[model samples]
Target: MVIGPDGCGFDMRSPSEMEADDARREADEAAHAPRMAVTSRIRRVAQPPDGYLPLSLFDEVRLADPVPLYAFEDVPADVTGLAVDYLSRVARGVPARDAFRVPLAGARLVGRSADAERLLAMVDGFSDRSVRAACLLCGFDAASRRGPARWRAGRVIDPGPATVYNVRRMVARTLRFMDRVGPVVWEGFTFDGGYTDRVTSGDGDLLTADGLWDLKVSRWPPNPTYTLQLLVYWRLGLHSTHPEYLRVRRLGLYNARSDTMWSVPAARIGADAVRAVERDVIGYADGL
Candidate 1:
């Protein structure tokens, strides 16, 4: 529930918050920027003995190369990730009211406009707010509320048929991954507790009965940075006062674009590598 700067200290504040304390936030970011360089550290130090895509336990859950339900045109991966994540919640029966309340509230402040109404009508009801949230998360203001693809001339352009098709297709694949993994215990949660500081804090994607999972929409397989990110999340989870993370026995990546899943047991990651990241990159407190 605590929203702030992401792992690299990128300010995720609402537009209003940015305007209100821009100067102070910039100063703080400058002061802590060095410690926020966790991604660079991961590239340098985070290596697993078996490599990024270690043998998966779920080898039986085969997925074909992603085929678009509609004709495919390229879309931003970030936007696609957000849409699929939101739709996952809806598929799992999360009430529309429960998702994207933060960004939706921001949207409300922007007030109902013709574009907003048009957008709401465009999506299946469950995911309407999610599309709005994606817009803001991607970069929205009072000006660009309909999101990147659908915004034009200060108006909400109707989503092209193909865009909607691709989003639904991707969401279906994510649901397939979830069904294979097991029921989700948590989604869009941060490893909230003292282990995280302003610099090393981030929200993780999903946790199921099987393991902790991150949803990636990238076409490529898990890279060193992505693998290290998962490891760091696990360490933070263990260090956090939150007890639910103790249930995590594996770290996983589900690539929505490729429709493939990669996972490794916590024990498979090199202990020395993890320790090095804890001390050097994440900068966890002594004795944590």
Candidate 2:
């Protein structure tokens, strides 16, 4: 299900059709709407009297859509903490570290988001094996097979999709998933229209600055790459699909099992990290 050539869905045909369709769509979109980047910077009009939206109103938008493609893993607060610890170790370059003996209990959320209840619910349903699964989904063979328990030396990890892999293809799915996060619902902030989901722009849940939060459940070593993934989703509002929708002032990672969490400004995490990952992924596709 590749979107049109330019990463917009109006052109729903296959890759071959993308080039010409993209041209036409770009022209039409150009005349009708501004570039996503520019449009996003313009900011959406503040809604409601106080420049804020209520929790229940946001629920209606959540209900409008039949399915949410972006994954919201329901993992325990404790397990998330463990992931954080494990990440710290990996980042420190303790190649031989093992995660099996580490217990998952102390993971605490450092910040909160608008979808707090739903996010917590999702984490409740999440499994510790998710990272491994992501590797598999990317079409690679991985062996270290890390879990909530231990790490291994000489573990053959999958680098993920090769060059020649379709950039437009792989990223579109990821981008669309990134696009659906609701507007910032924390009462103090407001949004512009650049954001939208399958239903409508500004339709989903809004996390007031207080509402935006993330939980990490770990099994393997820490990865700067992993942290950056979180930053990218937060900082750019997953590509700045809408204005002020994800104005994240406070973001953090919780280590559930250990009752530990680290909160930081989105900028402190370094914006280029995710872009670097994106670049590598694209390079993989090119090699393919």
Candidate 3:
């Protein structure tokens, strides 16, 4: 019924609007007029956790990791998510309402991988435009009118295999360059509303050696807006589990096509940035 922020993807059925739309469709089908369809822009509202601050340059765009300082202050777990939940249903090969009954084996489920896989699994739940939305959300593809949506088992799913391969290759190269990368702890994960599915911790999500590592995926590239995202997860572990923030304090960003992993310093990240994110978490808790 209701589409994304943009109000397209549905047949306009108001008597006047439908008449116009149908006439346009018929004209196109009959080669009487150039094919025409209505498209409307969706207005975006700026909203984030109090402590986290806005991720965009100002208000023109959104951030990558809105979660870094998002305290979930007033956000209901169900604040807004149905497409994502549907994808999880398809990916796990189970109904969304049903509990995940399958057992885990050697799967390193969590973080980016889980998001990507869930997108892979859920095909039917999305409309044509929604697929594009997911790709943009994951940084795999930009929202373009052209290009066929890569369907996964008949769903409009395409996780840009080319980009995924690129990420894999870069990580391997980084490991070779450093020569002492830590064993990735696949700490068993569950989808826990990071995007509709809640991925539980302790199960191995992907981690770099010593908790700091480089992520080189064919993505839109992480920016300051999204960096706090990694920071939040990092803080989760830092504040709760590790606390010492030891042995790991770096992140490298590699373009999906590029070879070099640009190392990031966990310690070197500015205090203001850290404070901004901390404020997000605290603000949520404090209900600010």
Q: On residues 33-96, what C-alpha lDDT tens digit does candidate 3 reach at each position?
A: 2221011000111224422322232212121222122222111111111223223333334453
| lDDT of candidate model 2 versus the reference | 0.31
Q: Which is better, 2 or 3, measured by lDDT?
A: 3
Q: Tell me how many clashing residue pairs each candidate has.
A: 0, 63, 22
The C-alpha stretches of model 3 lying farther than 4 A from their native spots are 1-153, 156-211, 242-245, 254-256, 281-288
Q: Report the C-alpha lDDT of model 1 over 1-288, residue by residue, as the tens digit.
A: 254566455556788877868878867875666443233345556455753434443232347854745545344555567667766776787754444443344344555444344443444443545454443332222123333343333333334556556666778899988888877898876766634342354667898875998888776666667876787778777877878788888888898777888888776666666766676667764423
TM-score, prediction 1: 0.66
lDDT of 3 at 170: 33
Alpha carbon lDDT of residue 278, candidate 2? 31
Candidate 2: residue 159 Cα off by (Å): 34
lDDT of each: 0.61, 0.31, 0.34
